[model samples]
Target: MSRLATLIDEGNRPVVTAEFPSIDGGGLAAVEKAADELRPFVDAVNATDNPAAHAHASNTSIAIAMSQFGLEPIMQVVCRDKNRIAMQADIIGASLFGIQNIACLTGDDVTAGDEPEARRVFDLDSTQLVKVASGLAEGHYLSGRAIKQPPALFVGAVENPFAPPLDYRVMRALKKAEAGARFLQLQIGYYPERLENFVAGCVEHGVTRTTALIPTVVLTKSAKALSFMDESVPGISIPAEMIARVAGAGDKDAIAEESYQLTLELSRHALSLPGVSGIHLTDFRHDGSLERLVRDLRIGPAFAPDPVASASGTTSV
Candidate 1:
C-alpha cells in the first residue's frame, strides 16, 4: 500500500499535503524545484492539472516527473476535460506508473479560464467519477469486465465547507463517502467557526467516522489575491479583517510576511479541530513558502518511514 493509504487506514497523525500549479514553462525544472524545496516538508505534492480551465502540462505527466524525482504526488483528475472512457484509461495508467493518490474534482467551468472557447467534456461529475474509480480499484471495469490485475488506489474527493445551503455541504460529503471516497479535501480556511460547524455536522450525520476530512489552507501573497477570492470565487469566504490587514501592510515584503503569519495561525487553528485527518496547504504563487512554514512549525515528519499505528504515535502540527 502507498504511504498515504496507510496513514488513512491508521488515522493517527495528520497528513501534510502541498499543491503546485503545472505551468507551461519551466517543465522538469519546476518539478525539480518543488521536489527540492517541498519534498522535505510535505507528505505529498498535488500536481494541479489546468486548474480553473487554464492550459498547462497534464497533471499525470507532471506527476510522472515528481515520481522520477522520488516525490509522492496526489494526481488531480478533473472531469471537465475528458469522457468516462478516457478517465478510466487515465486511472489505469496512473496506477501502473505508481501514482496511487487521486483527487476527483468536478472542475471549474470553462468560462472561468483563459480559453473560454475551449470545449468541455463533462461526461461524468465528480461523484460518478468516484464510483468509477472505486470500481476500478476493486478489480472490475466500469463495463463489468473482470481485470486481471486491479489498481491499488487511495481515492479522495473535494468539498466546499462555506458553500451556501450549509446542510447540503455535509450531505454532499456523505454522498461522496457513500460513492467510495475514503478521504475528503475541503475548500476551507479563514473561518474557523464555520469549519468547526462543518465538522460538527459531519459528526452528527455519521460522516466523520467513515471519511477523513482534510481542510485546505491557502497562503495568499497579497491583498489582491484575497480580494479576487472574495469577489470571484463562489464558495470561499475571506474575512474582512484579513483583507484590511493585507491592504494596510506598507510594502511587498511586509505583505508577504503578514500573509505567511496569517496562514500559519490559521493552519494551527485547523489542526486543533475535531475529526480533521490532515491539512492541505495551497501555495498561491508563494515560492518555497510552504517549506518555510512547515520547517518553522516543526511539525511531525514530512515523510514518515511508516504510518503511525495508533493515536499514541507522533503527531504532526
Candidate 2:
C-alpha cells in the first residue's frame, strides 16, 4: 500500500499533518527542513496558500516539495488562486506527481492574505472542487474527456465548527461529502468542549460515516498574528491571557518554546480522545517548533521514524 493509505487507516491509528508555513520564498525550504526534521512523526504535509501575504503557494515550489521531499503533500487547492481551468490542471498535475490527497477551499479573500490587488477567483467554491476531484478520480476529466489513467485521490475538505450558525457548518460538510469528500479537517477551535460538540453534532446530523476527521492546532505567540487572524480568519479566537503569556516571553526562541509546549499539550489531549482521528500542526512563526513538539511528545508505534538524522538539530524552532 502507498504511504498515505497506510497513514489514514479508518480503524485505530491517527495521522499527523504538518502545516507548511507561508514564509515567502523561504517557506518551501522551511517545509523541506521540517520534513527532514520530523520525518518519523509527520505522516503528511498540508500545503496552504497564504492568500493574505504569499505570492508563492500556487507555483512550482509546491511541486518541488512533492517530488523532492518524498513527503505526502496535501495540496490545499484554494479557489481564490485559480479559475476552473487552472484548478483542473493543478489537480491533474499534482496527481501525476503522486500527490494523492487534496484539501478543497474557497480560499480566504485577497484582503485576508493582505494582497488586495490579487485577483480572487472563487469561481467554483469548495463543493465544486470536490466534485471535480471526484470526477477525475473516476477516470473522467471535468470536461468529460477520458484520461489515460484517472488520478485516484482521497479528497478532504475543511469545516469551521465554531461558526455562529452551526447548521451551516454541518451543511458544508454534507455538501463536501456529497461531492465525494473522504475526510474533514476542521479549523482550530479554542475550547475543547466546542470541538467535541462539533464532532458530536456531525454524528447526530447523520454524517457520521464521513470519517478521518482531523483537528488542527495553531501555535503562535505573535499579537500581530492574532490581530491578522481575528480580522481575516473567521471563528478563530485568541484569548488575552494567552496573548499576555506569549508577550511576557523574553525572546522569539522562548516564545516558540512556549508555543511548542502548548502544541504538545494539545496533541496529547486530542490523541487521548476516542473519536478524534488525528492532529494537524499549524505553527505559523516558529521554524522547527512543530517538529520539536512531535519529537518531545511520546507517540504510539504507528508513528513513522524521526526525520532528523540525530537529535543534534536545534529544537528552538
Candidate 3:
C-alpha cells in the first residue's frame, strides 16, 4: 500500500500533502526542490495539470518525476480534456507505473482558461469518475466489461464548502462518498469556523466516518493575491480579516511571514476539528513558503503536534 493509504487506513496519523505544479524544463527545478525539501514532512505530493485549463506539462509526467525521487504522488485526473476511454486507459497506465492515488475533478469550464475557444469533453463529472475508478478497482469497466487485472487505487474527490447553498455542498460530498470516493480533499479553506461546521455536518450525515475529509490550506503571499482569489476564483472564500491582516503588513517580507503564520494557524485549527483526516497545502505563486513551513514544522516539537491527540483524541480511520 502507498504511505498515504497506510496512514489513512491505519488511522491516528494525519497525512500531509503538498501541491506541485506540472511543468517541465526550468520550471521543474522548483518542483524538484519542493519534493526534496518536503520529503520528510509531507506524506504525498499532488500534481496539477494546468488547474484552470491552462497549458502545462501532463500530470502523469509529473507523477513519474515524483516517483523517480522516491516520493508518493497523488495524481489529479480532470475530466475536462479526456473521454471515458482515455481516462480508463490512463487509470490502467497509472497503475502500471505504480501510481495508486487518484483525485477526481470535474474541472473548470473551458471559458475559464486561456483558450476559451477550445473544445471540452466532459464525458463524466467527478462523481461519475469516482464510479469509473471504483469499477476499475473491482475488475470491471464502466460499460460492465470485465478486466483481467483490475487497478488497485485509493480514490479521492474534491469538495468546496465555501460554495453557495452550503447544504448542497454536504449533500454533494455524501453523493461522492456513495459513488466510491474513499477520501475528499476540500477546496481552498481560509475560514476555519466554516470548515468546522461543514465537517460537523459531514459527521451528522455519516460521511465523515466513511470518507476521509481533508481540507485545503492555501498560502497567499500578499494582499493583492488574496484579493484576486476572492474576486476571480469561483468557489474560494478568503476571510476579510485575513486580507486586512495582509494589507496591514509592513513590507513584502512581513506580508509573506504573516501569510505563513496564518496558514499555520489555520492548519492547527483544522487539525483540531473532528473527522478531518489531513490538510492539503497549496502555495500559489510562491513555492518557497510551503518549503519553509514544512521545514519549520519538522524542526521542533512545538510546531509538530501529535495528530492523534489533535484529532478529537481518537484513532479511528
- Root-mean-square deviation per candidate: 3.4, 6.5, 4.1
Q: Using lDDT as the measure, what is the rank order of every candidate, best first?
A: 1, 3, 2
Error of 2 at 253 (Å): 7.9
**Candidate 2, residue 53: how far the Cα is off, in Å:** 5.5
- The TM-score ranking, best first, is 1, 3, 2
Return the clash pairs for model 2, or none. Answer: 39-307, 40-304, 40-305, 40-306, 40-307, 51-113, 52-113, 52-114, 53-113, 288-317
Write candidate 3's Cα lDDT for 218-310 as tens digits.
777888988888888777778788899988988998987787788888877887888988788887746567656655544212245666576
Task: Spell out the clash pairs found in candidate 1.
Answer: none
Per-residue lDDT of candidate 2, residues 30-92 (tens digit): 657756654555777777655444576563356447447776677788888778888888888
Global Cα lDDT for candidate 3 = 0.82
Write the residue-wise lDDT of candidate 1 on 1-317 in tens digits.
77877876777678888786555778688778767777777777787868888889888888888888888888889999999999888888888899988889999889889898999999999999999998998998789988878988888889888878776888999899999888898885578888888988888888877888988888789888898999887567788998899888879988988888888888888778888888898888557777777666555365433444533365543
TM-score of each: 0.91, 0.81, 0.89
Task: Name the 10 consecutive residues with the lowest summed lDDT in model 3.
Answer: 295-304
In Å, residue 33's CA in model 2 sits off its true spot by 3.3
For each candidate in the order shown, give its overall lDDT on alpha carbons: 0.82, 0.69, 0.82
Tell me the spans in candidate 1 whose CA falls farther than 4 Å from its real position: 285-287, 300-317
Candidate 2 stretches with Cα past 4 Å from truth are: 23-31, 57-60, 222-228, 231-234, 241-261, 285-288, 300-317
In model 3, the runs with Cα more than 4 Å from the true position are: 26-31, 285-288, 295-317
